[model samples]
Target: MPTPAATTTDLTGRLAVVTGAANGIGRASAIHLARNGADVVLIDIHESGLAETAEEIGRLRRAAHPMRVDCTDNAQIVDAFQRIEREIKSVDILLNNVGQSARERASEFWCSEPETWDFILKLNLYTAMTCSRQVVPGMRERRSGKIISIASEAAYMGSQGVADYAAAKAGIIGLTRALARELAPFHVNVNAVCPGPIRTAAADRLPIWEQYLKETPMGFAGEPQDVANVVVFFASDQSRYITGQSLIVNGGRWWS
Candidate 1:
């Protein structure tokens, strides 16, 4: 088998923008890109974690710019992207990784509250839209770009409590498909990755995550790198012909 480095060219001059990159799969993906020679721009709401992530990437001798911005805010997203373009030059890759989940509870379309419903949509779906819209214009101008959104397995399998989050993620899947079709003419590939049972700090807070792992086909919880590796594939030339698809890194949890 070819070494991972041999599978992708040196991304030395390429600029990559990764949102929610302060920790978890986002952090791993940003680091992986840097290891392979891509200059990375890390954006997250968590300023301290962003700083730590940037420092680690710097240790790899790769250029890393860490910024704090609310991805759900349109003006903030616009300003951040423009600043990155001006300072880092251009963005060749965009990873929309910002996501949040609320405590799951019994609910149906009939009993859902408006506040929870809008919060889920605004945080998950609108955030991705704001970031994608900012980076895509320049990508279209260059006639080349790669965009990846991190989704979740619940969107497909239907989690019991997080109805709002699942609906938002399902919307992300649709958005990925639509954007891929629209941007195909510009040579931009857009896709989403659905990760299940990855052991992150946040995962520790949820009791259901362990139950999900107990039922996984692989019989083990995943590490951040497992998901990061797939994201790297979608962002690289190896996946040039792939678009509008959702690659599940759930270790056979859902089989689809």
Candidate 2:
């Protein structure tokens, strides 16, 4: 039988791939993993942010490869994974982090447009589907891998204006749970982290900050690290027995 996976949190000698890693939770997660001794691959569409993240990874003395790709583009997704297999060699962990909600104030669902719906579905939903597909082969071959995705509380709470965003993120949760059941026999764990009101520049521009604040019992917005910490646990063997589960990192905001 294959040896048991490491239950400790140390990621030395492991390789991790994080999507949407230009800033916020993505950036924090990449650095945190690197600090714990994992070589990281950062993927995002923002060239400047990717460069900055790469430079910081360099300072940490861990290998960081930045790949720029429009998350919605299937061809670019394939190319990114091919480069990862060629350059990074293997993917011990995959963090599906590319996502966004439309920047607008509260409005009725009727105001949602098809263009917006399509954009939200592609970024928040399809990106994870494609990226996860890319890594499953290698993981299945080795009979081990960790897949951690960044979902959101809006998925469960049902944010009114960003209905598309909520639906897409909810789809991620469904994907994680379903994939976990299939991948479990291969020793690959799949789980998701649902963050609430993370205080990032993007969050600042959110139209419903007050709504989030009122929902959060902690009386403050969560930071990127708050979400990243749970991600690290899920990515490591520390969460070996946990699968098909979604953890809400909202500091007691939403229980579901």
Candidate 3:
């Protein structure tokens, strides 16, 4: 097999906008893009973490613009992206990474309240959709763009509990594929990344963290960098012909 290092090329003049970039996969993806020579815009509700992440990118001599906004709020997301375009110019790559479950623990769909379901759906599904709407217009005007969503492997499997969460993630994949078809004429690419058990802070707080490890075939959790590398690939020209694809980044473990 060919080594991954050999496949990447310099992203000298590209600009990538990453949401939910305060930590976890989002942070890692921003670092990877900056290292590869892409100007980065970091968006997250966590102001301190966002600034820290931007500083890390700055150390690499990359321009890092940090924006603090509640992704779940449509108005905030709208204003944020508008400012991004006005000040930074068109976004060449849009990383729709702002998503979260209502709670860390799983909840049975039948027993869950409608309010819980609403929160989960809005966060996981609407955030991506809302952000995409803002960025795609600029992309279309330029006749070039890429949209990469951070979906979940739970979308593919009938994962028990968290039914609302699973459904929302599934919706992302659907949106990616459909949007790809519409945006293809403008030379815009759309794709999704479905990562498995990544050992992020949220996962560490899980009650059954140990149990998850036991099921992973790799016997360890995946790191944020692992997913980050893939996001860079999707954002790069190397994947020019690839769109509407969902890359599953599980450590050889399948849980359903």
Model 1's alpha-carbon lDDT is 0.87
* Reference-based TM-score, model 3: 0.94
Ranking of all candidate structures by their TM-score, best first: 2, 3, 1
> Quick one: how many clashes does candidate 3 have?
0
List the lowest-lDDT window of 10 residues for candidate 1.
1-10
Candidates' TM-scores? 0.92, 0.95, 0.94
lDDT of each: 0.87, 0.89, 0.88
- lDDT by residue (tens digit), candidate 1, 1-256: 2443435645678888999999998999999988878889999999999999999999999999999988767788889988987877888998989887865533665788888888778878998988898888988999999999999998999876788888999999999999999999998999999988899988877867778888899998999899888887888888877999998888898732
Task: Kindly report which residue pairs in candidate 2 clash with one another.
Answer: none
Separate clash counts for every candidate: 2, 0, 0
What residue runs in model 2 are displaced by over 4 Å at the alpha carbon?
1-6
Model 3, stretches more than 4 Å misplaced?
1-7
What ranges in model 1 sit over 4 Å off? 1-9, 104-112
| Candidates' RMSD to native | 3.5, 2.0, 3.4
Question: Which candidate has the top score in TM-score?
Answer: 2
TM-score head-to-head 2 vs 3, winner: 2
What TM-score does prediction 2 earn? 0.95
